[model samples]
Every structure is written in C-alpha cells, then in structure tokens.
Target: MREILVRNTDLSEATPILAVTEASLAEVLAGLGQSAGNWCAVNDFSGRPSSCLLIPSAEGSGATVLFGVEETGLPHPFALGAIVGSLPKGDYSLADGFPDPEQAALGFALSAYRFEQYVTPSRKIRRLGVGKDVDLDRIGIVLDGVKLARDLINTPANDLGPEELAAAVAALFEKHGGAGRVVVGEDLLDENFPMVHAVGRASSRAPRIADFTWGEASNPKVTLVGKGVIFDTGGLNLKPGSSMSLMKKDMGGSANVLGLASMIMAAKLPVRLRVIVPCVENAVSGNAFRPGDILSSRKGLSVEIGNTDAEGRLILGDALALADEESPDLMIDMATLTGAARVALGPDLPPYYTHDEGLAEDIAVMAEAAADPLWRLPLWQPYMKYLDSKVADINHINTSGAGFAGSITAALFLSRFVENTESWIHFDIFGWTPADKPGKPAGGEAQGIRCLFDLISERYSSAQ
Candidate 1:
C-alpha cells in the first residue's frame, strides 16, 4: 500500500509532479520555460479539477507532470489524488503548491489503492518522494489499516466465512500482544451467544465470536463491537439477485473495526482496548430460524424476528450486551445495518447515533479534520414504540410493515442492549464507495475509521 511513496530519490534526475492550482498556474508555467508554457497553451490546460499535462524533458525518457488542483479553495480534500491514476511509470516528487503536504501525500496513497488479491499486482515502477515534513511511518500505518479493511471486504464470501474471519481477528490481536478466544459452532450457545448461533447455524461454516483485549489494565477502557454478517442471503426471506450481489461486503463493519483496531495497537496507545465481533453468515436451510422465531439474547431480552433480513441487529444485540457488561469508558459499535441509512444519507456519509453530546461534538470535529464524512441521526425516543411487540421484549426491526424512519428505528433497537456505558455511539455505515471519487475508489472503502482513530487518540492521549 505504501508502494507509491518513497523517502529518498535523486531529485535532480527525477521528474517533478507539480500540483498546480489556478492561483499558482502562471508562476508555475513561467518557471517551466517557454517550450513547456507553449505546450500548456495548446493543450488548453487551465488547471481544472483533475486535468493533467505532461511536459517532456531534454531527455525523452522523462517528463514533468503538471497536476491540476484548486488546493485550499478546492471542495474535495483529495483533489490532488488525481495524479495517481494519470501518472506514468517514473520517479516523481510532489514539488510544491499544496497547503497541507501530509493530506496531499495521504491523498496520493489513497488513490493508489487497488484490490488485486485475486490477480498479480502491478509491477510497474512508480515511486513518489514524500517531503521531509510528512511523517512517513504514521502514513504507512494508516495505509495498512485502510488496506486491511478493503481487502477483507473485497474478498469473496466463500473464502471469508465466519470461521475464517474469526481466525483473522485472532491473528491480528496476537500480533499486537493481545490474546483472545473464539467460541465456535454450538459452543456459542453454551457461551450465551444464542443470537449469533441462531443466525449462523444454517450455514456449513460454524459461527464464532472473537473476544479480545490489550493495553494496560489500569488505563481507560475502550470497547468496540462490529456486526459480522459475512454473507446475508436475507435468511429464508432471500433477497433478489441485485440485493444479494454485494452481500459479501455485509461484514464490512467488522472489517472497518479491525482496521481501526490495527491503528490503535500499532501506535501503542495508552488505553485498554477490547474488541467483540460475532461472525456469522445469514444463510438459508430447512432448519434455519423462521420469521416468527423469538431469539434469546445475552442481555436476556427476547427478540421477535419480525423479518429474517434484519439479522444484523439481533447478533449485534448479543454482542453489544456482552461489551456493555464492562461499562468501558467509551463503547462504539459499527454495522451495515440498514438500507434506510443509505437512502437518507447516501453512501458517502454514515449516520452515527450517540446520546452523549460531548462525544458527538468531538466526532464532528475529528470527522472534518480527517476528511471522513459522518452525520448524526437522533435516537428519537418516540420511535421506540415502533419496535414494541406483544410476543417478546422487543421486535428486531421496525414493527410497522411500512418501514418509516428505518435507520433511526434500527439504532433504537440497538439502544436497548446498551445501558451501562456512560458514552456509546453507533455507526450505520454503508462501507462501500458506490462511485469513484478523488481519493476513494469504487470497491470496499474504509468509512469512519480515520475519524474515530483521531477521536480515540485525542480522548486518551498521554498529553491529556
């Protein structure tokens, strides 16, 4: 992932990839000499959003890259990422003109990402010289975290089922001096993760929950819960071809949480970190739990399965209940839980639900700083009536068949399982970038990880 960035290169021999904004275009062109200036005029390169113009050098083998951007005045933070796809195989340096070189460098790395696990990676030689001011090690950690989430989400479901995902989590924690165990198959029921077993028992792969912790015991306790629906076939209510096409990414929440966890541990943050992920595949079988089934939860709430497709919340209900037992300093859960969230905010901005106003405010601050889009949706206590059921403590989805306020209602459903924590936040993330943007490609994207990392670090920093 850091292949695009380099620390050392011969500047005199290497071609410079200049990020030219409208404000600096004239001076930049003048410095490039008359021949290159004439090339720009004929090409009509006026420094538009993603425009690029290559100026040949005295040596025909090399060329200077003039990448267009609006810089600080630009609407998108990663507009400079345009050069990643446009540049040819060569050694290049981002010479100047970006207000924030670190963000500009990060943008280059983001656009350089490609999910090439199934095929051979590109062997073309392309290296960038990130200036001295940028922290190369920090950027590398962030890139690796993003790559981990994207790779897990992009892999096919057959290769990434519940058992495999549990193994991945165990290996990750072990790598960072943390230890964890997974209660697999029928043992989940024995471990009181009944909802997890109920959702995954239909599949051949045994379902499991990965519970782990790291950092000093006396430090601030931070717990993270991610819904790991490896593949959601909507259970017996089976979705249409289009709806099920991307079900492999249903476990994206777990993938993203793991990415954030990787950053925290790699940085050696001074905090006690706990991660709880219930990995399950919502498949179909003759013995699969039916629509009317009332599932027992770890929290002791009987959840009536109003719709089999609403399996994420049921499993999360159990997982969140388990996490809240410790009443950690802060608890956060992420899930690709509802289509209603997508309809309301689209794919770019995930809606977060949190009752703690101070935490919400910090999230807002970090989100903008990280250029990771996140929005807040209310708990709307009045909507709790929509989840009421005569047969059980609560229904796992909107009780009304018409499906009004679906995202808010899904959040309200999870709220019931979390009561002990002083501050808890829920992220209903889309997790996939539907279309390619400046720094974001169209495949599995990591949402909220960057912003949340910054938030957590600030909250528990040694300086604090």
Candidate 2:
C-alpha cells in the first residue's frame, strides 16, 4: 500500500523514464546529445537488462532517467521493477520507447511493496505519474490483492494463529459485502471435518474451517480451497532448527486464495465464488496425532498417517472433499505441500496438477500472460499405488517409496477426495522467494494467484 501514483499530472511536466535496449542505445544516446552520451560511455552503460543511469541537465540537476530493457523478444512485464530501488524520489512518466506503459506502472507499484508490519520502511520509492492510457483502477485492484497476501504470509505465528487467520477471512468477506462463516474446534467433528480437527487438536489455539461466499448463486460455481496450517512443528515428527525456521509460512496457501478472492470480488467477475480455508496448527503435545495413526476423513475414507509433517495434504483432503460435494464448475486447491516440488522446479515456478488437459493448456497460456509461471504435472494414476495402505483406504504419504515423486503422490492423495468435481487443479507452491528479485522480495510471496485470476476471469466473465 505504498503511494505509487501522482494523479492528474501532465506527462510533459514529469521526468521521462526512457527504456533503452542494447540495439537502441546509440540512437537513444544521440537523442539525449553529447554530455549525456559521454556520461553513458564513461559509466560503461551497455543497456543490459536492469541496468539504469541517471542523466544530468546542463545545470547539473536531474533531467531524465535511462532504464535498460532486453535487446530481443517482448518486453518483460516486470522490467521497470528494477528501477524502483535506484530511482530518486520524484514524479516520472514513461518515455516513448517504453513498452506496455500500464504494465510498467504496475511493476513500479509492486516494487514499492515492503512488509512493514513490525518495522518502518527505511525509504519511500519514487512515485509515477498516471498516464491517460493506463487502467489505474485495475492496477489498484491487483495491488490490493497482492499486498493482502504478502501481509498475511509475512506476519509471525504468535500474531496470526488459526483463530486469527479465520478472523482475517471474515473481515475480508465483510469488506466485500459477502457472507462469511467459521466452524471452529469440536464443531469441526460435529461437521464431519475429522482430518482437520485431528491434525489441529493438539494446538491450544484450536482448529477451524473458514468459509466465504460471494456473487449470485445462479452464476457458474467456482470453489477455492487452501491449506491454512498457521504453524507446523511437524507434529510428532519434529523438524530440525533449520527446517522449522520458517514454519510461520505454512498458511501461505490460504493467504494466496484470499488474495485471489480479493481480485475476483474487486473486478466483479460474474461467478459464484466460494473460498474454504482449514485453519490449524500442527503442534506437538500429548494429544498430537502421531505417525501410523488411522483417522477417518470427511469423504468417508480412512487415512493412515505415514508422516506427521505431511499434514498439509491431510487438511486439504477434507476441504476438497467438502468442495467436491458442491460439484463446482472449477475446484482449485493451493498448498505449500512438499519440498519435492521445490527440488524439481525450484522456488519461482510452482507445479500444478489436473486431470483436465484443456484446462492445463489454458492455465499455461494465462500464466505466461500474467507473468506468473506455472508448470503442469500429471495426476499420474499409476502413482496412486504408492499411497496404498494395508489397514486403511489410503496412506497420508508414500513412506515406503524411494521418495521419487513426492509431490505427485501428495497430489494423488488429495485427488481421491475430489471425485465429484471433474475440473479440479491442485497447486503445490513454495511460498517463499528465497532472495529478492525486482518486485518480489526475500520473504513470503504470492505465487499463482494472478495467473489463476486471469484464467478465472477468462472462463467466467466471457459468459456475462
């Protein structure tokens, strides 16, 4: 929510932001004249992507800024993000050479984001003047969504436990004039969400399932479920210091879904939206669920616990089962489910699973368009065998297998609870960025929400 725009300002009065490519560097330098050209050469400015230079006027005052773009291919949506940190605090406008000025403005706003809930920001980023052609409203909506997700994920567990997480969802729905409800503690057992209750019963804060609904009931039904484990101690299977350091981000999936819901509501997309978040804390206590313990699920299937750390999929299974019963046109579940996915595709690109081939192809296209990348991994029915349990209907994880396809097996386990829904997709995301990059910083990030929002808008909005 940092101020990113100086509204109603004429572009001619603002400093120009010139986006230069290696091929266009000389032409751009010539346009700026001798002193600027010599400054560029002396500074060894080769117009490399993300490289920037500040041009000085004859009076030795700031005149214009030169930003570098790629020499070939379409302009990156986030290319302008690189200049957010370097630019002096002032008002500026995109010059003629910049591509997709609207996107550039968005990148500038996103780059200004900082998780300042605990500490104040050191400095403010330069604000940009809004051009006539830019869709300022749309940009504002997207920024609000992204900031909400980042804030939720960045908060520490002590301030954002299961009850607090549920409260956040309620406040969001209320803001949008939607209906919100929560089934907490033992009420989950009365409501048949056994897996959610069992996994979280050990925590003193108590477990709950938060639900939010919006739009006309006659519209196409789109259900979203997210894993909301507030903090994971790995249950009876405790994690080491290094592995448990960032367990506060266990609810990132829920945060991301809330973010997506914000965009859908803000845009007034014509779809009946339902969001489900199973809020829990996988803590260790005398009553904590242990490995090899058998628990019944909401879908009437028995699940034998293989490892307590794999509790993300367990909570999601029950939520998906409930969502499936609604037979929504599209059912999507997001979770920070496995490290195996990180090993396969790294942290930036999240892998999704779905039985619908056409949906997968469409999502890939939208992901690229939104600059949020996703890889489609098959449900791979053959891997279902790895989750087989001799005493129960399924094992929470494939403990006996050589850990070859951990992410796939986790997806397969959740897939069992989603038989009623044909259009279902599961996202296994690593919510942390690991390091700072342009608009994204080294903390909790919003992964697939933007791309998913684009896909949802295309599928449902066109019908209206």
Who wins the lDDT comparison? 2
Give the alpha carbon lDDT tens digit for every residue of 146-204 in model 1: 98999999999989989889888988999999988888998988889999999999998
- Candidate 2 residue lDDT tens string, 1-464: 53686553644466788888898989989989999999998999988877889898999777888888876532578778867777776678776646777777877887778888789776655778766778888778888999999899999999999999999999988888899799999999999999999999999999999988998999999998999999999999999989999999999999999999999999999999999999999999999999999999999999999999999999998999999998999999999999999999999999999999999999999998888989999888888899989999999898666887999999999999998899999999988889878778779899999898889988988878
Q: Kindly report which residue stretches of model 1 are placed more than 4 angstroms away from their true locations once superposed.
A: 8-12, 71-75, 462-464
lDDT of each: 0.88, 0.89
User: In model 1, where is the ten-residue run with the lowest total lDDT?
Assistant: 7-16
Model 2's TM-score against the true structure: 0.96
State the displacement of the C-alpha of residue 301, model 1, in Å, after optimal TM-score superposition: 0.7
